[model samples]
Target: MEQVKVFTIDELMVATKNFKEERIIGRGGYGTVYKGLLPNDQIVAVKRSKFMDEGQIEQFINELILLARTKHPNVVRLLGCCLEVEVPLLVYEFISNGTLHDHIHNIDGASWYSWSNCLQIAMDLANALTYIHSIPIIHRDIKSSNILLDDSHTPKISDFGASRLIPLNHTHLSTVVQGTLGYLDPEYFFSSQLTEKSDVYSFGVVLAELLTRTRPLLPVRQTDQNCNLAAYFIQSIQEDNLFDILDSQLIVEATQEQLIFIANLVQRCLSVKGDDRPTMMEVAIDLGELCKQPTNLSPIEREM
Candidate 1:
């Protein structure tokens, strides 16, 4: 509800208690997030990057510009940014809850990971993607960890550091490959041609996670090997073992019709050719329709 245009580093220092370790809320490759209290008692999440090299300053500025222009309920709101210091800082509205990753993995702060909740989260993220893509922007990185949750479990898509704005004249952009390993689009990985479909491909991995409630990467044998959940999912589906990969909790709660519908949708999103994938807007609409369908499963039934 509170909006901060820009705050001085001194003010942020006061708010975050001089960046005390106790105020640190989250940590990632980009930087750390701190839970801060502003002058008017406004609660916010402060993102401070460790370093911005010669090549990354533009990406940082691009992130700030994109965040500044974003306006959506599902996308995290960027209140302001501080550029006075060597390490730029971004202030965002605090999401009281946690990331979708926590909920899906039953990590600390996990509330309820019911089928309905997962569906709603997917719908929310899809809607956020739709809005951003309509602005002709590619999130570049889309994953459960990037999706934050509020007190009521509403999702807010965050982290625009890897985003790129596509010109109207172009359908895709040629750029360096950047994204998480598990969710990386195969076509983009090979071609270095970034497009909106790349996001769709990553989102398919999210949908797969929702179905299976497993990390995108999985530990294998004692040899330190790992399994890629995306390939695992496609293999399972193709072998007619889709149900085998489903989250145990969802099996009893989800309907056969709905699961098949969503699984089919995921297949399209994960299509080998980006040209065959659905647009974010189309995916958003389909997910919205999926979640809105009436169900016989009760709340207690879903929780089990």
Candidate 2:
């Protein structure tokens, strides 16, 4: 594992052109992220903390320590940090292709990953979650926006601000539940007891997004009733309308066996009880296998 370096804020400022508006790539609850070039000519994403509160500061150090200690092809690599500034900053490998959310939401975007690409990305993401789980860490937030895609559509899990490091002997932890609204695990939401299974629930939602290309929650303008995608998805699955909920492109491009296999897998991930949900390792293996099935065949050819 690479030890995180300490970079001067001045160097960061120079690389990001004094943090110009155009350099800003993303904004989140944690802070604003700016795209920059390192003194060594390496492109990086600089996450500047907006909140000076103790909690926010802890998340910064927590992510730094966790990311420095862990290394995986599917997880974003933390290059360094700058603590001299009023707000601390963390530098990560810059992924130019943007986030899974961007591709999923912006259907017309040039960076959109195809059905096959989405499957491959999910496998990589599962591998990342499994790696972290082996280390006994829980990524409290596991949403599309937190997942960055590389140029080849390879997904790298990012944003560990809400991550928790679990002790070796502990089964779960009690904390004030903090996660995105729609992707939040109902079990964790009710009990405030978090475990790796919470991440599974969130991953399930991600799979649903990939399958349906729909937001977890409906847009405010769409209806007075907020749409719960998972609930609707599960209902559709029970009613044998799984294929109906699928994106039109996927419906035609993906084989029936392939879609059914993934629907079953996602269903397992979204199990109501945490204990009932498959572990990240199991989920990843299943997705890996699912991705291997041929997708270019016609519907009749697939059945034959």
Candidate 3:
């Protein structure tokens, strides 16, 4: 692997053209991401975090160490970093295809992404999560927005701000629960005990997102009540009415067998009990195999 060099604050400023609003590609609770052109003419994504407390600074260091040690096609590559500035900045290879959430939920934008493309993205994300779990790191935050896409529409896992490195001997670590609400593992949320399974659970939610093509949480009916898609999906599965909840587009294109396979996988991942969920490795392997099989033409039988 090539060594990543630290950039000076001045250099980064110049590359980003003084952080122009036009160059800003994304923003989140932690920071903003800007598209930058380096002196070498290489395009990169620059993540600039807001103010960091002592503990956050330590977590930033941990993220750096983790990214530096890990390299995989499905995982975002760290090009360099700029820590000399007031707020720390992380440079990564630019992914042109944008976030999975945009393609799935944003109706005003392009909508040509086929069901096959969605499947590939999900498989790629699974591969990345499997790699992270192999190294014993729990992402704690796995969502459509966190999975970036390259020019070819290949998915790469990004955003390590909420990640935790677990020791080999430890089954679970007690820490302040931190993650997006809808995708968070319920077990971890209640107990504050995190494990790799937490990431698996979140990834399961991502899979559900792909299948349903809906936001994690959405308003139901005329009331102020909100419905979590994950919880709703699990309930639908139990009632044998999963088709009623699946994305209409996906249902039109996907075969019954294929949909069942994917639904079963999602159901297992969303198991309220972490012990019942499959490992990331197992999930990845199963999805990979599914990718290789040709889609069958059998029609889905509507559940009575």
Q: Which candidate is the best by TM-score?
A: 2
**Residue by residue across 1-304, what tens digits does model 1's lDDT show?**
2354878999999999999999999987688899999989999999988776754566667778888878999999998888898767889999988888887888554447778888888888888899999888899999999988898899999899999989879999999999998999999999999999999999999889878988888768332333878877777788898898897667777787788888889999999999999998899888888887765577787699
Q: Please provide, for model 2 over 19-128, each residue's C-alpha lDDT reduced to its tens digit, 9 standing for 90 to 100.
A: 99999999999989999997688999999888788888888888888898789999999989999976679999999888898888896783455677778878888999
Model-by-model lDDT, in order?
Answer: 0.86, 0.88, 0.84
Off by over 4 Å in 3: 108-110, 222-226, 296-304
Q: Sort by TM-score, best first: what order?
A: 2, 1, 3
Q: For model 3, how does the per-residue alpha-carbon lDDT over 1-304 read when each residue is reduced to its tens digit?
A: 4477799989889989999999999998677899999988999989887666766576567667778867999999998999896656888899998888887787675465666877888888888888888787888889999888777878888888778888878888999989998999999999999988899899988888888887887667432343787887787788789898787777777778888888999989999999999998899898988888776444554432
Position 215, candidate 2: lDDT: 93
The worst-scoring run of ten residues by lDDT in candidate 2 lies at 218-227
Clashes of 2: 0
Native-structure RMSD, model 2: 2.7
